[model samples]
Each structure stands twice: as C-alpha cells, then as structure tokens.
Target: MELRRITYENVDAVTSMSVRDEQQNFVAPNVASLAEAYVCVDNGYAVKAFALYEGDEPVGFVMLGLGYMGWSAPPCAEGSYCIVRFMIDQRYQGRGLGKKGMEACLEYLREKPLGSADKVWLSYEPENTAARELYHKLGFIENGEMCGEETAAVRDL
Candidate 1:
C-alpha cells in the first residue's frame, strides 16, 4: 500500500473508511464538516497528509502535522515536530493497516532534517485505549493533557 494525498475527488474513498460506533463518537460535524483531513493537506502548515491506497483503492488515511517550536523541545526535538490522524474503513480493520499508516508517519519523521523540535504528538478520546496503546507501543507517552473528547501524547524524535 502507498500513502498519498487526498483530493476533493477522494472524499468518497476517505468517507468509505471503516469506523466503529465508539470511534465514530469521537468524530463529529460529520465527514463533510470535518476539516481535520482536508485542512491539513491543503495547508503547508502541516507536515504531510496522505491516504493509504492498496492498488487503486484507498483503505485508510492520516494527517501528520509538524508541531511548532517553543518550550516544547522535550516533547519533540527542537526545530520541527509532528502529530497525525488516522482511520481505516471498518471492513478494512484487523488487517494491521493502523500499523502501516503509523509506520509511514514514523518514517516521514525519521526522514526529516534532525532538529530539537523533531517529534510527533497525537490525541485520542480518553476512552480509546486501543488507540492509546497502539500509540504507546509506537513510542508515544501520555502528556497528561486532555481536551474536549480526547487526551494528548507525545513521542520524541
């Protein structure tokens, strides 16, 4: 599979992603109003945003944002930082696609020019332990901060 940018033409593929009722609970304003994916990809402010495509099919996606510089070095490295949003179509789950999407995010980070601000952060609903755990195993640590429907975590690069 390859991770590529999502276009207005790909909303169908993106909305086609699998999401559980509980997971859906975390996403709101419906797919149309959720600019989480659209905004990041269109704005250069984000690191990179892409869709995971298997052949000609898009099975999942993520939006990786480079964190800003400041007193946030320990959370990141020092110059550039990052975060991501990911999802797979419900019918596409259990095939380890989450790992694939995350691996791309990590690889994207690894390939960046080294700096103190080089790291990635992510947030998930406090009740979403599965996502929290996957992020943990991938090297994220809880930042002890929670907002709205989610809590935050960070991984130093």
Candidate 2:
C-alpha cells in the first residue's frame, strides 16, 4: 500500500472513509482531520494528510502534524511529530490495512522534512485496546500523558 498525499482527484474518496461502528469513538472522520490539517498549516506547522491506497483504491486516511510548536498545544517533546488522526474504512476493517497504513505513515515520517523528529506521539482512548496493542507492537510506550480523554504514547525514532 502507498500513502499518497490527499489530492483533488482522490479527496472525495478519502473523505468517505470511515471506521467500523465499534471503533468510531477511537478516531475522527477524515473530513474533520483534513480540516484540522488545514488549520495546522495556517499555524505554521507542517501537516501531512494522506490518502492510503492499495493500487488504485483508497483504503484509509492518515494525518500527521510535524513539530507542533504552538504555545498551548499538547506537550510534544521537541522535534516530535504526531499521528493526529488515522482510520480505515469500515468495509476495509479486519484486512490489516490499519497496520499497513501505520507502517507507511512511519516510513513517510522518517524521511527528511517530516522525519526530523526524535520521537512521535499518538494517543487513543484508554478503552481502545486494539489501538493500544497495535501501537505497543509498533514500539510505542505509554508516556503517562493524556490528550483529552485519551492516553498518550511515544515511540523513539
């Protein structure tokens, strides 16, 4: 799978992606994430919003905010990026796309302009065990922090 930048040609499909009912509370919709990305951009942060694709098909959306240096933003360690939002379409659930998409996100985050961070932060609702486990397997450890009602985790790059 490839994580391609969201573009006019595929924006519709990307915005249509949604998670399964049980997982809905774990993530926000793609449209909301895209809007937030724009806001981040206006604030001088480098935001990457991607449409995850399997060949020609859009499978999910992933958004990242690089070096969020805002004064009142969550306390991200210096030079850290955050996977602000990520989700697989409800129809695509159980196919391992989430894991694959996440791996792609990590790869994309590790390169130059976006990859200058020494760490990456992501958070999930404490009730979202699947997210917690997936992140743990990817080497993220609880940093004893919170993003609203979600517990935060960090992974060293």
Candidate 3:
C-alpha cells in the first residue's frame, strides 16, 4: 500500500464511499469540487490529505489538520497539532488497516518537529465502540471526560 496526495480522480472514491466510512465525515460535494476546496494545499493550514492505495486501487483516506501547542487546545495555529479524519474502506474495516492507517498518520505527525506539538488528538462518537476501542488499544488516552458522545482521545507523539 502507498499514501499519495488526494486528487480529483479520488474524490469519487471518497464521495461514493459506503456509509460506514461516510458516517465518520459528511462526505459531500463532488470529488472535483472538494479537491478544489480542500484546506490541505493551503501552505499555512498544516492540514494535509492523502489517499491510501493498495497497488493501483484507492482503498481509503485520511484528512488531518493542525491545532495549537496543547492537547485539545484551541485551534488557531499554523502547525501545532493535527485534528484528523481517518477512514478505511468498509470492506477492509475489520482488518488491521484502520489501526495501520492511523499509525501511518501518527508517524507522519511525529516527524513534523519537536515544538509544533507532540499530542495527537481525535474525536469520535461514543456509540462508535469499535473505533474507541481501536484507539484505546493503540494507546490513545481519553481526555478525562466525554464531550457529548463525541469524546476526545489523545496520544503523545
């Protein structure tokens, strides 16, 4: 598998993604328009997007954005933290790819720098037990309390 920049060709892969993937994010608009409007390419946003391909076929995706210098801190920085949108193809969900995908993203974040922020943050619906457990097993600690079922989890990078 390989990770590459998201492009118009992959937008359809994103938009038409199954509900299992779609429920994680409101995958709206056509691929072309979404690509055109993405924040990842903005030099100052510290937001990057990638399409994961197994050989030549796009299999999944991840969208990550930076925040401040604190864990779950306010989001007003150029490259302090990363708020992520991670997803895997429904067909590949139960496999280890989701964990692998998040790990890949974390590895990418860890290479950013020493001061940009070392805490990795992600939020998910409380009912999404699979993801919460996946994250917890991966060593992400819950941030003391739940935030409307959209509890926040963090890991030190």
Regions more than 4 Å wrong, model 1: 28-44, 68-80, 113-116
Clashing pairs in 3: 66-81, 67-81
Scored by lDDT, model 3 comes in at 0.62
Q: Which model, 2 or 3, shows the larger lDDT? A: 2
* TM-score for all models, in order of appearance: 0.73, 0.91, 0.72
- lDDT for 18 (candidate 2): 77
Worst 10 residues of 3 by lDDT: 69-78
Best of the two (2, 3) by TM-score: 2
What is the per-residue lDDT of model 2 for residues 58-148, given as tens digits with 9 covering 90 to 100?
9988888776535344576457888888887888877888788899888877884565677899889999988888899899999888877
Q: Kindly indicate the candidate among 1 and 2 with the higher TM-score.
A: 2
lDDT of 3 by residue, 1-157 (tens): 5667766777678666553544544322334334533533443435566776777877777766666322244232334455455667777777777777777777777877334676777767777777788889888877655433467777787
Please, what is the whole-model Cα lDDT of each candidate in the order they appear?
0.64, 0.82, 0.62
- Between the candidate structures 1 and 3, which one is better when assessed by TM-score? 1
TM-score: which candidate is best? Answer: 2
Consecutive 10-residue window with the lowest summed lDDT within model 2: 69-78
Alpha-carbon shift of residue 49 in model 1 (angstroms) = 2.5
Write candidate 1's Cα lDDT for 1-157 as tens digits: 6777678989777766657877886544226423654564465444455677767878877655555422133333224455545777777777877777677767766766333345567778888877877888898887775444567777776
